[model samples]
Target: MRLVLVRHGQTDANVRRELDSVPPGAPLNELGLAQADAAGERLATHPVTSVHASRATRAQQTAAPIAAAHGLDVTVHDGVHEVFVGDLEGRSDREAREHFDTVYAAWWTGDLDAHLPGGESAHDLRARYLPVVERITDGVHGDVVLVSHGAAIRLAAAALLGDTAETLYVPNTGLVVLVADPAAPSGWALDHWDSAVPVPGDVTAGGTPR
Candidate 1:
């Protein structure tokens, strides 16, 4: 089975660059709703068999259209939630973001223990996220779609794909396609990656917490 890992739609926190990675967090903005629809439409031709989403409200909202299009209901998983921001929750400023970046970059340097003051370490997230993905993909025979946060998706992908995912960026509604691979370490290999890196002069551009 192939896994289509998607980042949830945009939120006001995403626009303001706030570190909002908590459960039942901000809902999608207007543009985000449209983006969600587009994502569903984008997969209309694919034979999607199952759909799953994180516990976050935005993730559920983002999963709705995709599930509806496939005549399936979204299964919510508690373990697939975003990396807990703990002490960094609700802060939106240059310092907080830079601090987040600094700590997250350490994870790329083989420091899975590095983390924000009270947030989850890279090791912590891999433990929580990947097993859930493996479980869902294992039982499904076709495509399994998962809607989750940017940071969580990238971190998990890094663990599965090794260095190829270290610098990967998955923006709102972006898709990371993974095909089952018995030869791969994590039993998955990258197929296609959809990156939403904003173009120059694009004001609609806002950073996601990838």
Candidate 2:
């Protein structure tokens, strides 16, 4: 089974580069809607069995088309939303961005415990995020698609594929594919990371890393 984690399409908040991490967060803008449709088209070729989305409006909206194309109903799941940004909930200022970048970069450096001013740390994200991934992908016979936020996907993917798999950027509607590795201890392996350079793993896992 492959765990196909996807970032939801663009939003006004995304355009502003703001940290909109809460539930019912920004809806997909017009371009985002188009992107979602395009994503649906792109992923339609995959052998997807289940479609799931975070609590955010944008994620669910992004998921609708994919589910429709697959003849599947998207199952909404809790505890799978974006990493909470408590005090930094809606700021895009230089200071806020700098602070977030510092903390997030630390996560890549193995400091998962680093916390946001009043938000969640990379550790916090894994605690609430991975179980949901486990649950959604548990005993699945085919691929699973999860529409979620960029930062959350990056953090959790690193944890899932091991600490060495960290990389930046999860473009809107881009995918992070983790194929099940029943032979490996983690039960998953990095198959591809869409659009990110210096791709992790063997880079031979196939299926369009671009």
Candidate 3:
């Protein structure tokens, strides 16, 4: 099965460079709504059979349009939620940068046990996130969309595809596509990562690193 992991559209916290990783996360801003529409438009052409999203408001909102286009109701999964920021939730970028850098660097360096204060380690995240992907994709056919947060998507992509895969920052509304790999030990292969899709000007372009 092909799994398309999409980062939710821009949120107020994203524009303000603040962390918002908890239940019922912030809703989409205006540009974010437009981005969601554009994503829906693009995905409407794909052979997506199932639409999944995190319980977070932004993720659910992002999935709505796509589900509408496909006549499919979104399946909410807690495993796709953002990395738990814990004490850092809603904190300013300046205050959170050090913590973000430390933990994320460890994620890139293969230390899945590292995490922020009162937050989830990379290992903790993959434990929940990968299983959701595995369960959803198991015995499934055609394509599927999984709308989720930035950190969760990136970390899960790296974990599933292997350490050599790029762990780049996923722009708002970014797309990552993966497919089952029977030959690989990880059971997955990256078809694309942070793929750029045309959206409003505020949304940036990204994809697999060249």
Candidate 4:
């Protein structure tokens, strides 16, 4: 089985570098749509059998073009949602670093026990994400695409690659490819990973380039 994990495109939260974990979702901005389209074009050559997305609006929107081209519906999976930020949600990176020192430290150190202020821990994230991956691997026999959040994708990749959590970094709309073979002793191997925007020209929102 081959798994292609993609981080959703930029949103206002992304541009502002705010932590977005709240409900009622934020849809993708223009650059986001273009990134999603670029991602779809890149995957057009691959034999993707299914597309899965988080319930988040940005994720759903990012999955749409790919699904349309592939004639597959986006499978919404709540388990793939971004890490809940609690009081830190909507806060800027600077603000988070200033006020949530322990949380930031934990994150920097890749501490599994570090929890966001009133939110879930990295360990909690692994618990939630890994099971879904297991299910996908068990059910899908072909290439699968998953559009999700940055932190979640990083955690998933770290877990799958047996690397330190702090070692994983995925840029906006990044793609990380993993090949899982039950026949292999390791079970899974990293095939390729990149955050290169596949779009040819500079994408714009309204009249301004991002």
Every candidate's lDDT: 0.81, 0.81, 0.79, 0.72
Query: Residue 107, candidate 2: how far off, in angstroms?
Result: 0.7
User: Which residue ranges in model 3 land beyond 4 Å of their true spot?
Assistant: 195-210
Model 1: which residue pairs collide?
none
Could you arrange the candidates by lDDT from highest to lowest? Answer: 1, 2, 3, 4
TM-scores of the candidates are 0.92, 0.91, 0.90, 0.84
For 1-210, candidate 3 gives per-residue lDDT tens digits of: 899999888877666666778879788999899999999998998999999999899999999999999999999997878888777888755657567766777767778888778988888888899889888888999998999987788888888887667666677778889898899888788887764443433222221110
Per-residue CA lDDT of model 2 for 1-210, tens digit only, reads 999999888787776767788899889899889999999998898999999999999999999999999999999988878888777788877787677777777777778889888888888889989999999988898889999877788888878877666565777788999999978677678999886442232111111111
TM-score: model 4 vs. ground truth: 0.84
lDDT: worst 10-residue window of model 4: 201-210
- Give the poorly placed runs of model 4, Cα more than 4 Å off: 98-110, 164-166, 183-186, 195-210
> In every candidate, how many clashes are there?
0, 0, 0, 0
Per-residue error at 152 for model 2, in Å?
0.6
Candidate 1's residue-wise lDDT over 1-210, tens digit each? 899999988787777777887889988889889989999999878889999999899899999999999999999998888888777788876777777877777877788899777888889999999889878987678889999987788788878786555346677898998888889876778988877666422112323352
Model 1 lDDT vs. the true structure? 0.81
Candidate 2's C-alpha runs over 4 A off are 196-210
Of the candidates numbered 2 and 4, which has the greater lDDT value?
2
Model 4 RMSD in angstroms: 5.6
lDDT assessment of candidate 4: 0.72
Compared with the true structure, model 3 gives a TM-score of 0.90
Displacement of the residue 91 alpha carbon in candidate 4, Å: 1.5
